[model samples]
Structure formats: structure tokens, C-alpha cells
Target chain A: MEIISFMIAPLAATLILGGILVYFGIHVIKREIVFIDIALAQIAALGGTLAIVLWPETINGGGHEEGHHLIEYLFSLLFTTLAAGLFSLLKSKKIRIPLEALIGISYAVATTAMVIILDKGAGSDVHIHDMLTGAILWVGWDKVLRLAGMVLIVALFHWVFRKNMMNLTDNYDNSSYKSKRKNWWDFLFYFTFGLVIVEAVQVGGILTVFAFLIIPASTTLLFFSTWRARILAGLLLTVILTIPALWVSWTWDLPASPVLILFLGIILIISGLVYQIKKKVT
Target chain B: MNTLLFLGPPIVISVLLSIILGYFGNHILSRGIIFIDIAVAQVAALGTMIGLLVGFGEESLGLEMTSYFFTIVVIGIFALTKFADQKVPQEAYIGIIYCLGLGLALLLAERISGGSNFISKTITGNILWTTWKDVWISLLLFSLIGAIHVFFQKRFQSISLNKSENSSINRTRLYDMLFYMTFGIVIVKAVPIGGIFLIFILLIAPAVSVTLFTNNWRKRLIGSWIIGSTGSVTGILLSYSLNISNGPAIVCLLGSLAVILTLWVILRKRTVSV
Candidate 1:
């Protein structure tokens, strides 16, 4: 049963995450800002790192101190929400510096600040290293359930209003260029985007989230033109990648993040080769 | 007096590195080849990890001699990223190469460490953990970087900046190869100080900070060096005293300085209007 639960843990996380990505990741790719997800994840990491670095201060009368649980989620949510909100608000069309640069800066500041902060404190600690890497062995039933609930809620909302979300990302200029209500729809995408980064960070750090956000979505956009196929492809790819990653990490004693990343890399390379072959043959 | 000496080396190194990287990086950034910086830094870092694993393992010399030797390997691999005129944007190639390089490094490190322990340092980079020996090594690296950058400074400017002059000039494919060689070296040397996380800022930020003030590439380079120099002096102290990460503090300082100057420019604009 313990082994079964352990196996199910990765399966559940992958399915839930893959389903959500299948629905939304395609559009994120279409926007040509796949790096934005990584940026948002880094921002979330920044927030979480800040909170973790400061949590000790709260105990010593620093009001900015946060609970361990809150530290993990709150800061990331704050940054992601604020950033996503701003991106939606501006309806940014072709920012000169890809949003990834902003995210990279966020990581630079957060990771360094975290080191300084952590160095000063001595205590009962959670090494955030594993969380960021998504060592599948680290995922438990609780994490799986929480992420599942979040994904379910997101997927449901996506179902009822898929048209609005698609319109906002696929043709933002058309939407905001002519209609105002569409701006509100963009808000929903940003909200979902922010929420995914926050929740994913608490569960699997940024790398896994970044890889799925870009690779699967881009892969779909490459082969499939319609929104529905792209979403299905993304969902399938995320699962296909995640399962093997978890198994390989366990069997080979490798880190899950790299395993997951390698799986994505393999998929990307294979897909690229196939795409090339098809182009040649046709 | 204490602070000046404390900050002197890193500040100098960062400024020098910034100027050298500026000529290559700015071109890449403008062309939207951002991930290339990350990809290159990561490949070099994996080389460093191999150096660390071998250096610390009974014999240290093997590590030092071999770590940078891997740059040749990365350059050879990265050269293929252009993929014989395949239309994939340079940034896409960068992302692919960076992920592949990092995956290779992570696999190697885990095999040696037997766990994912060193990964924290691998991904984020730990500067406070830097040794004086590394500082000395960085100084030598910067000197070498400085000599090369200044030597061909005009050529870089002419090729990347002066497009109209391209037809008239005869710098040749050798010039392109020289730039890539320097680009690989900058990434290799910048790894320890800037790590994968902050090199992009050091590469692009000071340059970005400088471009706001001047149109001339020389002036832009000088302005960026000044910003880097000032940030280096201040950031190291801030990192030491306030217990902050020096890299981000440097970046924040860079960003803050940019904001102040930007504010001044807006103020000047208003004054002129009135």
C-alpha cells in the first residue's frame, strides 16, 4: 500500500497538472512567451524565498515573518498575481525584453537574498532544494490532493469559458483593439497563470513548471493548429513525460527534475526530428 | 578603507566582464537571443562541476586544467545549434542547449554526490562560498578578458554596430569565430561570480543601464562600466554588512541607478518643455 501510494502520488500530480496544461499551456505557447511561465515561477520562487528568509525574523519580533506553509505559497502567489495582473492589464503586445528577462531578474534577486537570509538564521528547517527539483519521491498524498483540487477548479472554469480565454491569448490585439469585455477575459488567464505558478512551486518548484509550460505547449503549437488538438497534445505529452521521469528517478536513483527535464528534451528532440522528416517527405 | 579593498576585485572584474560581454550580449539581446546567455553559462558551469568533482577528489590540478578545457567542447556543441541554417530562432537553440547542458551536469553531479545536494548551489550559485584563490583566478581571467575586448574593441563595434560599414569592411569569418570564442570564455569565467542566475544581468544590465545615456558605443560602454563599478563597490559592502546576496544587490543597485537617471531625464524633459 505504501509503495502503491508512492506510485499514485506522481501519477495524480502529473494527471492533474497535465490536464490543466493541456487546456491552457497551448495558448501560452501561441503567445510566443513560453519563457513567461518560468519567469512567473521564478517570481513565485522569489516570493517564497523572501518569506522563508524572513520567517525567523518574525519569531524574533519581525512582523514580516511567515508560517512555513504560508511562506511556501503566499509570497509566490503575491508576485505571480501582481505580475500576471499587470501583464493582463497592459495587454502587453510584443514587449522588447521577453517577460523571461523579468523572471530571470526575479530569480537572481530571490535566490541571492535567500542565501543571505538563510545564512543568518539557525532553526528547524526545510531545505527548499528538493521542492524546486520535484524529486517525485518527495510528493505525498496531501500534495497530490491539494494540486488535484486546484487543477479541477481551474479545468472546470476553463471548460465553461474556454472561448473567452482562447480569444484573449490568440488575438489580444483584436480583443482589446476593438472590445473592452475581452480585457476581463484576459484577467481570468492571468489569474489562472498566477495560481498555477504558485501552486506548482509549492509542489514541484519552478523547473518542472517551466518545462511543461513551454515544451509541451510549443510542441502542440508546432503540430496542431486548432486549440482543441493542441490542448489534448499538451496534456498527453505532460503525462507521457512525467510518468517515465518518476519511474526513471526511482529506478536509476536520479533527481526527478533532471529526469523530467530529460524526458521533455527527448520529446522535443524526437518531435523536431519527426517534424523535419515530415517536411522533407511532403 | 576596509570596504574599498573588500569590494575592489569583484567590482573591477564585473565592470571589465560587462564591457566585454556588452559587445556580444547586446547584439544577442536586441535580436531576442536571451536564453543563449543562460544556456552557455549552464554548459560552462557543468564543466566547472566536473572540475570541482575532480579537483576536490585527491588531485586538484586535474580539475583546474580540465574545467575550462570543456569550454572547447561546449563551443563545438553550441556551434551546431545554428543547425546549418535551420530557421529555428537563436533563442530556441539556446533554450535547447541550456536544458541539455544542465541535464548532463545534474546527472554527473548526482552520480558523484549520490544525491541532489550540490544542485542547490548548481542552480542558484553560492558567491559567499567563493574563495580568495577563486578571486585571484577571476582577476587573471578578467585581465585576459580585458586585453582581448580592448584589443578588438573597434572590430566588435564595427561589425555589430555599424551595419552600413559591413559591406566596406573585410573582417571575415575569423571575426565571427573570435566573437564566439570570447563569448564562450566570458560564460566560462563569469560562472563562479555571476553564476547561471545573475550573469545575464551583469552581461546585459550595466550595458542596458549605459545605453540610456549615450548613442555612441564607446560612451555607452564607459557608462555601463561606471554603473557596474559603482554597483560593485556598493553592492559588496551591502552584501557584507546587511547580510544580502551581493549579486542581486548589485542588480538592484543597477536597476535603482537606472531609475534615478530615468527620473532625472524625465525631469529634464519637463524643464525643457517649460
Candidate 2:
């Protein structure tokens, strides 16, 4: 009972976060901008680190002081919006470099910049470890409720723009170069994406957020084709995987985020194998 | 003068890393596998973690060999998955591999005492503490890798730049395996000295900046070396004066340089159009 009670918050957090992430993941995978989430997550992290640097009071031992989370969130969101603008702008055909290369460079530069900032300002090496590992297991009910509200708003936003969003991702290769409206839609998509990533990274850390975003979607894609089927199945898969992953992590005293990621990776590999075998059998 | 003497080895190592990584960065950019280095570096770090877990001393030859072995396996996986690019983009796989490696490393880090320190050190590196022995070893290893690249220059160029349809699938796979194998080896060696962040910047920023200006392969390579070396030297000096970590300092310098060059290119194009 105690363990179950303790696990409930994290499990709920995962499901809520996982729901939106998997949806975004499908679009991300479809558009083939697979690394964009990680890049944005790093940029958000850079923002959060800069906040800590500017206001050292935010660094109370390892975690931030109470009520300062909003400031940090806003800082990260501001940085992410700027990056979203840059990404949307850079989608020009004149640029010969692949978008993936630019994304990778963004990730590298953001990470290194964070390192420099952390070194100079707070001098907290522990913050780097914290950012990567996250505090999913220690998540409170307040945070979960807060996350739910944000996810709902974003989910509703996506639902309203479903036609534009779906069309953009579905026919990305065909329509992207033709439409000037594509960039506007891209900015909106990325801004919402940044919102989710900033929150997701806060809860699940970068790796878990990535695993939640990519692995479930990739796994579902191996078994399903349609977006409707893929998103529904991916969300279902994440929900199923989260419970066992949390249980295993709790029972064994393992780190929650990585164990969850490893579980996702295992499921993805199994799904790939099953897909291959089904192809052979049919 | 005293500062120069103290920072000499680090400066040399940084320049050396930039030269090789700059060359490989061109290949990476052309191949559209920019995140491959990060994936490879993460896997190598995981291998090192595993080696440590299995009781290999931190600086032991066995640990080094274990790291190399793990890197080779990832290189092989990447080579095999190259064909799957038709079905799924390679970037997805690279991203997956990176996450898996990082997650597993974190899981393992939880087991070791002071493991978080090790993890942070791998990311930030300890370039200031580098000895002359480290410099000589990297020089010898880098030169050996450089010689191999020079020897097989034509095959690599054909595969990476041209992606010629003339080459057989198996032959291309072999060349790719060979390419990533050398690339992985360089990353493994360089990660210890410059850390993953610095190493990534060293690999990318120079090649990216140079490619902004030139089309010729020789010009790109020479330009990359010049840009890389200058960034490295200036970065080291700045870090020394600022009393900051060398790797991030260098990364910031190179990163700014790349950004400046990119903005210049974009603005120049705009002006020309006007």
C-alpha cells in the first residue's frame, strides 16, 4: 500500500506526459525530424541553467526553492520559443545543409553553453547530472496536476489545428517547400512542442522524455500504418510500459528514468523483431 | 610564458582533435549523420562505465580496450542498419541508440560510488589536467588514423560525398563500417581529453564554418584545419585567463565562430539579392 501510494504520482505523471509526447512523437517521426525533441530539450535546459546562473537563490542545495519553478519554466519557454523561431526560419531550400545537421549543432552548442554557464555561475556540476537524470520518482501531486493542465491546453491546441498539423506532417516532403504558410504552421507546431519538452524534461529528464517520445512511436509504427492507429496504439503502449517500469524501479531501487527508457528500448527491439518475423511469415 | 608552458599540452591536444574531427565532420555533414558522433561517444562512455563496473581500473589498458570493443560493436550496428535507411531514416536509429546508451550508462552509474562524478567528468572532461603522455599517445593514434584515411581517401570520398550508385551495397557497407570504425576510434580517444561536448564542437563547428565558404574538398579541409586550430588556441588562452574549464570555453569560441560565419553567409546572400 505504501509503495503503491508512493508510485501513484509518478505513474500519473508519466501517463499524462507520455500521452502528449507520444502524439508529438508520431508527427516527429513522420516528419523525420527525429532529433528535434532532444535539441529543444537541450535548449530548454540551457535556459533553465541560465536562470539558475542569473538567480543563484534558485539553487537551494540540489533543487530549486519553492515557487521559483515558474520563473525557471518561463526562462526555458522563452529560450525554446526563440529556437522555434530560428528553426522555422531556417527551413529555406537555399540552405544546403540538412536540418538534422543544424539540429545536432544546436544540441551540441546548447549543451556546451550550459556547461560553461554552470562552471562560471553556480559552479554546480551536480546540476548537470540532475538535468540528465531528472527527479521523476520524487515528483509531487502538485507537479502532476500542473503538468496535466499544460498538457490539456496543448492537446486542445493541437486538436483545433489538427487539419493543418496533420497535413503538414503527413505530406511534409511534398508540401513543405511549396507553402509559405508551412513556416507559420511549423513555428506553432514547434512552440507547442517546446512547451511539452520543457515540462517533460523537467519531469522525466532528457533521456526518458526522448524514449517516451521516440520509442513508443517507433514501436507502434512497426505494427501500424495510419496516424490514428499509430497515435492511439503508441499512447496505449506508453501507458502499459510505464506501470511495470515504475514498479521495477521502485522494487529494485534503480533509477526510475533509465529503467523506464531501457524498458522502452526492449519493447522497441521486440516489436522490430516481431515485425520482421510477421513479414517473413506472411 | 608560465601560462603558456602550463597550457601547452592541452592546446596541442585540442588542435590535434580539431584537425581529425574537422576532416570527419565534413564526411558527417555530407552523409547527413551529424548526430552519429554523439551516439558513438555515448556508447563509448557506456562501455567505459561497464568496464569500470567489471573491476577494470580507471586508467587500465583493459578498460580502454573494453571501451574500444563497445564502440566497435555500435559501429557494426550502424553499418548493418545503413540498409534500413530505406525503411526508416538513419537519424531515428541514431537518436534511439544515443538514448539507450545514455539511459544504460545512468542505470550503471547508480551502482557505482561517485559515479555521477564520473559521468559529469566524461561530459565536461579534464583538459587542464592533461599530461604530455596523453598528448604523445593521441598524436601517435591520430596520425595512424589520419594515415589510414589518406590511404583510403578515394573510397571514403566516393561513399560520403558523391554517394555514387556505381558502388555495390556490400562494398559500401564495408567502407561505411571502415569509416565509422575509424571515426569511433577517434571519438573514443578524443572524448577522454576534450570531453563529449568539446569534442562535438571541435568536430562540427570548424567543418560547418569552412563549408559555408567553399566547395572544393581540399579547400574545405585546409580551411577547417585553420579555423579549428585558431578556435582551439584562442579558446585555451581565454579559458586560462578566465579561469574556466577549457573544453566549454573552446566549445563556446568555436560555436560563436560557426554562428558568426553562418549569419554572415545568410546576410551576404540577402545583400546580393537586394
Candidate 3:
């Protein structure tokens, strides 16, 4: 009962973030840019590192000064949103560079920059380790409420721009100036996406954020066909995975993020194996 | 001036790694397995980490053996992954393998103190600290792999570039395994010396940069080697001057060059059409 009570806020937040991530995962899978979450999350991390560096006494210091957390959050959001815009622009048909490689490059650079910054003693007094893996097991109700608010705003945006989102993911219609206008919509999509991911990354860490963004949707793709079915299956799996993962983490005293990611992998592999066997038999 | 002397051997090693990686990178690109280098490097790092858990030091023979052992396992699995439906994107499998490898490493790292640092270390390792002995070993291993590749260059090229050739599924799998065998060897050896970031950049950046200029494989190989050498030298000098880590500096520099060349290609094509 104690453990469950403690886990309530974190669990709720993880589920909400997982659902949002799975929503983005659908577009990511369709666009075949699966690793964008990792890249953007790392960029967000870079922003956090920069914030901590610039305001040593404010963010992540012993005392959480008023508005410091917001500044850090905005810094992260700013970097991620800009990266999202750049990624959208790079989707220009004329550029022959594979977007995945570009994303991978950015991820590498961001991670490198992070290590260098951290090495500079910017996070000397703080346990900046959680910036990447995150402290999910330690999230509070206030954080969850804030995430819920962001989730609602993003959900409303998706509902309103549902048609544009679908077309951007599926159509690949990079023909003319009209497509360029559509690109701005895509930028808006990624910008809002960056906003969503920034909060999730703060709560769940990059690993969990990536797992939620990728595994559920990818696994659902193996099982389902339609968008509605995929999202439903993904959310169902996220819930199913989350409850036991939290239980296991609480019981065994393991880190929740890696445990959750490993479970997702196990589910993906099992589903993949089953799908392969079925294909082979039939 | 003293920094130049001390950095000379490592620079040579980096240049050699860049050339060797650039050579094999064409095949990786042609196969569209863009992330295989990192994937393989991660698996190999897991091997090394396992070695550490078993109480072997980083430079221990035991660590090297275990690293090679895990590399072999990952290579075999990656090769067998091809047996799946071709319609199903291979990237899914690769992505899953990468995440699993990383997640498992993190999990294992829990048992060992400061285990998580190994993950970042594998990505951007300390290239400037590599020893002369390791450099020679890398050169020899690369040579052996290069010999095999050179001997079977045509067969490998056909299998990599023209996938839908006259070959049965079994035969194709065999060739891929062979390619991965050599690839595994290169990655396992190079990773310890150059780190994953430097190796990945050398592997893809030069090969990719070459493609912006021409499609001919021979030309691309030569062009890649040249770009790789110059970029590596430039990156090393910058790292030395700026006092940053050698591996990541090279990766960032090369990454910048690849982006520039890509943009130039795009702009030129746009102007041409206009």
C-alpha cells in the first residue's frame, strides 16, 4: 500500500507521457525516422546542461529558486523546438542525406557536448546523472499535473490538426510550394512534439522517453493495421507494461527506466518472433 | 610543438582507422545499414564490460576475449536477423537490437560501480590515451580484414550493392555473415582504440561525402579515404589546440563537413533545375 501510494503520481505521469509518445511514435514509424526522440531528448538534455551551467545557483542547485525550473524547462523546449524545425526543413526532397543519419549525427554531437559540459564541473555538486536516465521513481504530483496540462494542450492540437498530421506522415507529397506551406504545419507538429517530449524527458529520462516513443508503437505496428488500432494497442501495452514494471522495480529495488525499456524489448522480440513464425508457417 | 610529437602516433592511427572504416563504409551505406557500426560497437562494448564484471582490467586479454566473444554473438544474431521477411523493415530489428544492447548494458552496469559511464565512454572514448601496442594491433587486424575484403571484393560488392542477384536465400545469408564477420572484426578492434563516435564518423561520413561527388565505388573509395584522412588530421589538430577529447572533436568536424557537402549538393541541384 505504501509503495503503491508512492508510485501513484509517477505511474500516472508515465502512462500519460507513454500515451503521448506512442501518439508521436505512430508518425515517427510512418516517417521512418524512429530515433528522432533520442536525438531531440538529448538536445533537450544539452539545454538542461547549459541552463545548469549558466545559472549554477538556480537550477538543480541545493535550493530550487522560484522560476528557475521554468527557465530550465524553456531552455530545453527552445533547443528541442529549434531542432524540430531544422529537422522538418531538412526533410526537403532535394537533400539526399538520410534523415536518420542526420538525427544520429545530432544525437552524437549533443551527447558529446553534454559530456564535455558535465566534465567542466557544471554539475559537480549535483547528481546530473538523472538528467539522462531521469529520476522517474521520484516524480511528484505537481510535476504530473503540469505534464497533464501539456498533454491536454497537445491532444487538442492533434485533434484540430489531425488531417495535416496524417498527410505529413503518410503522403510523402513533396511536389511544390504548397508542400512547403505544409512543411510549416509539419514544423508546428514537431514544435508541439518538442514541447511534449521536453516534459516527458524531464520526468522519465531519455531511455523511457525513447522507449515510450518507439517500442509501443513499433510493436503495435507488428500486430495492428489501422491508426486507431495501433494507438489503442500501444496504450494498452504501455499500461500493461507499466503496472508490472513499477511493481518489479518497487519490489526488487531496481531502476524503473531500464526495467521498463527491457520489458518493452522483450515484448517486441516475442511479438516479432511470433509474427515471423506465423509468416513462415503460412 | 611537443603536443604534435605526442599526438603524431594517435593521429596516424586515427587516419588509418578512418581509411579502413571509409573503405567498409561504402558497403554499409549500400546495404542501408547505417547504424550497424554503433550497434556492433555497443555489443562489443558489452563484451568488454562483461570482461570487467569478471574482474579483468580494460587492457586485459580476458576483456579482449570476452569482447570478441560478445561481438561474435551479436554479429551472428544480426546476420540471422536477415532471415525475416524483407518487406518488414530491417531498421526495426536494428533499432530493437541497439536499444536492447544499450538497455542490457545499463542493467549489467548496475552490478558494477560507475557502470553507466561505460555507455558514454563507448560512444566518445578517450582516443588520445590509446597505446602504441593497441595501434599496431588495430593496424594488423585491419590489414587482415582488408585482405579478405580485397580478395573477395567483387563477390562482396555484388552481394552488398545488388541485393537481388542470382543467389539463393541461404547463399545470400552466408555472404552477409562473411561480410559481418569482417565487419565485426574491424568494429571490435577499432572501437577500443578510436571509440564508437570516431569510428562511426569515419565509417559513414567519408563514404557519404564521396557519394555527393560520384557514384563509382572505386572513385568513392579513394575520395572517402582522402576526405577521411584530411578530416581526421584537421579534427585531431583542433582537439589538441582546443584541449577537447580527440574522438568527439573529429566526429563533430567530420559531421560538419558531411552536412556542408550535402547542402552544397542540394543547392547546386536546385540552381541547376532553376
Candidate 4:
């Protein structure tokens, strides 16, 4: 009972954060701006790394995990948001960049800065370590709540932009919405998108975040057409897998992120095989 | 004078590698092997992690060091993709290889070196203390590979674009000769610096940027190489001045080039319309 209850909070967090990422992935796949999503996600990791090491530890000089959970979660989100906003500014003309390329460069810069940080007395630092790879098992109440909040915000924003989002994806829709108050809304989409991707990193590290954004949403694109179905498929699949993965992580003493990714892969293979079998049967 | 000598080999290597990667990558992008490059590089990255695991953060493991760590995958990729089974759509197979390989890599990394080390090291690695020889070797391979690509540009272009189903070169089918060689070299070249993450950028980003504006394949090819080289030089300079690591700086610098080019294209299209 206690174990199950322990699991519940993070599960809710996963639902919200995972949903935002799934939506973000779906939208970016449409926009052909995934490379930016990719870069920003890494930058957010960089931001998290900087957040941890830049602060002076109390006694251990680094191993302030359980005590500083609140600080860690809050700072990760804040920095990731900042990184997202900075790159999203590529849409501005005065800044000078094609938004896509700007993102690629930003990814490069962020990752590079991260490399610098890591090299300059960083690898030894647990704060730098934890930020890049999320310490999922140790996720406290604060982290869960944070993820849930982001997820809720994403859900609200997604509900508002449903029509515009659909319109933007389809060519016919894009033509009509071209005149229907675009530029700023586009920023909203991309900005909120950055938040989703970055925050997902906090919950799941870079590898898992990429897999989270990509596999389910992309796989759903295989069969489903409607926005609702796609979101449902992505969310449902994510929940289905996240549970086993996390459970398996605790059981086998494996890392949650990799286990989650493997679940995704296994799900993909099974899904593929199912398709194959159905094709044969039909 | 020493600085030029210091910089000479890596820069030349960079230009050469950029040229090769650009030309071949353009061809591959047209042929739709973009993700394959990424997949293979990631696979190699997984291989390197296996190396790290074997060494256990220690440099040597006597005879057991770095051997067969990637044996399963090296053989798998080599056999499946070495131009033998080119008839069917092997793109899916290649993608599968990448996913599976990375999965194994993560598991191994997690088991041996804790999950955090597994994730961070795989994606954002350190090149802060690279040796001069490392730079020179990168220069050598990048140049050789780049020259080969330039020499075969016309052939690559023919195979890439004029996909007339039954071309004389059997462009799609002729992977036996070229793709594997390029594949092997790409892994070899990409391994030293970017880890698993940056190889795709090295392969695709510049080439894709060039594709945005230029319809003419020649210009597209040339532009990709130029942007890539410029990115490399710029990254090196940034690293020098900012005291940043080389790999991320290069990635960042090239990213800037891509953004700049993309912006110009967007604005140009916008202006021309009015």
C-alpha cells in the first residue's frame, strides 16, 4: 500500500509532463522544426547542470540530493524556461537567424557550454550529474507537483489552440489561418513547446526525453488521424509503458529512463509485429 | 607561427571532412539515408560507452579493453548494411539497429556506471583535454574522406538526385562500393569528438541548411561544405577566445550558420512576395 501510494504522485506527474511533450512532439513534427526542439531540450539540460554546480553546497559540497529537491526542481524548470525563451526569440528579425538554424546553433552552444561546465570541475560534481540524467527514483513531492503544474498548463493551452494547431498542420487550414492572427500565437506554441520539452528532461533525462517526445507521438502518427486519437494514443501508450518501466526500475535496480526507453522500443516492436501479423491474418 | 601549426592540421582536416560529409550527405539526404547516418553514429556511440564500461573509467583493461564491446553491433551493421541486402527497404532495418543498439548501450551503461553517468556521458561528453595527435588524426581522416567525396561528387549527385529508377550507376544499389566505405569512415571520423550526439550534425545540419535556398545541386553541395567549414573555423575560434571545449563549440557554431542561412531564406522569401 505504501509502495503504491509512493508511486501515485510521480505517475500523475508523468501523465501531465508526458502529455505536454507528446503534444509538443506532434506539433513540431508538423512544423518541421524538430531540430530546434532537439537543441533546446539539450540546452535545458545544460541549464539544469549550470543551476546545480553554480550554487555552493552546504557541507558535502555536492551530495545535497534529498534536502535540495525543491531547489533543484524549481531551478531546472526556471532555467529550461529561460533557455526556451532565449531561442524562441529567433522569430524576431532584429535577432538575426532563421529560427530552425538558430535552434540548431543554440543546441550546439548549450551542449558546448555544458561540455565546458562538465570539463571545468564538473564530472566529479553530482549536481551536474543529476541534472543531465534525472534521478527519477528519488523524485520527491515537489518535483511531482511541478511536473503536474506544467502538464496542466500545457493541457489548457492545447485546448485553446486546438483549431489553430490543426490548421497550422494542414495546408488547407494554414491558408485560412494565415490571416487569423498567426505570428504571436506561433510564438506561444513554440515557447510553450520549449517548456514542455525542457521540463520533460527534468522528469526523464535527455535520452528518455527525446524518446518520450518522439516514439509514442511518432508511432501514433502511423495509424491515427484525429488530434484526439493521436493525443490519446500517445498518452495511453506512455502511461502503459511508464508504469512497467518505473516498476521494473525499482524491481531490477535498473535506471528508469533506459527502462522507459526500452519499454518504448519493445512497444514499437510489438506494435510493428502486431501490424505484420494482422496484415498476414487479414 | 606555432598557432598556425597548432591550428593547421585540425583546420585542414575540418575542411576536408566537411567537404566529404557535405557532398556525401547531400547525396544521402536526397537518397533518404539521413537517419541512417544518425543511427549508425549512435550505434558507434553505444559502442564507445561499452568501451568506457569495459574500462570502468580506467583507461586500460589489458586484452579485454575495447574488444568485442561493439562486436555484436559491428558485425550486425556490417553484415546487414554492407551492400549485401540492398534490394528491399533496409532503411527500417537500419533504424531498428540504431534503436536496439542504443537500448543495449543504455542498459550496459546503467549497470556498469550508474544511470546518470550513462546518460550524460553518452550525449554531452568532454573534449576539453584533447591531444594534438587527436586533432591531427581527425585532420587526416576527415581530409582523406573529404577528398574521396569531392572526387566522387558527380557520381554521388547522379545517384542522389536523378533517381530515374534504373540508372546505369545503379546509384541506389551501388552501396556495396561507396556507402559502407563512407559509413565506416563516418564512424571513424565522428567518434573522436562529438560522441554519439554530434555526428548527425556533422553529417546532416550543414547539408540541410544549403538545401533550403539552392535548387542547383552543385551550389547546394558547395554551400553545405562552406557552411560546415565556416562553422568549424568559427567554433574553433570561439573555443579559443571563450576558453570553451571544442566539440560543443563546433556544434554551436555550425548551428549558428544553419540559423543564419535559414533566416535569410525566410526573409528573402517574405520580401520577394511583397
Report the Cα interface RMSD of each model, rounded to 1 decimal: 4.5, 1.7, 2.7, 6.5
Ranking by lDDT: 2, 3, 1, 4
Q: Supply candidate 4's per-residue lDDT for B218.
A: 76
RMSD of 3: 2.7
Give the clashing pairs for model 1.
none
Q: How accurate is candidate 1 locally (lDDT)?
A: 0.63
Model 3, span B168-242: residue lDDT tens: 878888878899988998888888677777788888888878876787889989999999999889988887787
Cα lDDT tens digits for candidate 1, A185-218: 7767877877766677666656666666666766
Top candidate when judged by lDDT against the true structure: 2
Candidate 1 CAPRI classification by DockQ: acceptable
Off by over 4 Å in 2: A55-67, A120-123, A171-176, B267-274
Model 4 lDDT tens row, B26-88: 665666444555555556556556666555554344312243335334544444453543322
Considering lDDT, which of the candidate structures 2 and 3 is the better prediction for this target? 2
Q: What digit string (tens of lDDT, one per residue) describes model 1 on residues B1-274? A: 9766666566556655565565555655444455667776677667767777654552355654465677666665555544343444444556556666666776776667533545554445545455566667766866686678679866666655645554422343455457666677767667665666556766666665555456666676667666666676677678778766676667666644543454455456556778
Reference-based TM-score, model 4: 0.75
Q: Among all windows of ten consecutive residues in candidate 2 chain A, which has the lowest summed lDDT?
A: A171-180
- Candidate 4 vs. truth: CA RMSD? 5.9
- Tens digits of per-residue lDDT, candidate 3, A42-153, equal 8887897798778888855666676687777778887987798778766767754567777777777777676666764344323434654787888988889988999999
Q: What share of the true interface contacts does each candidate keep?
A: 0.24, 0.63, 0.24, 0.27
Clashes of 2: 0
The CAPRI quality class of candidate 3 comes to acceptable
Per-residue lDDT tens digits for candidate 4, residues A1-282, read 787887776676666656777777676655545455556666656656676666647325657676565565566567666655454444543322234444544665566666667666445445444544566666778767766777778779878867775665554223334535556566566667767666666666656666666667667766676778988999889888888778888888886766777888788767766655766798
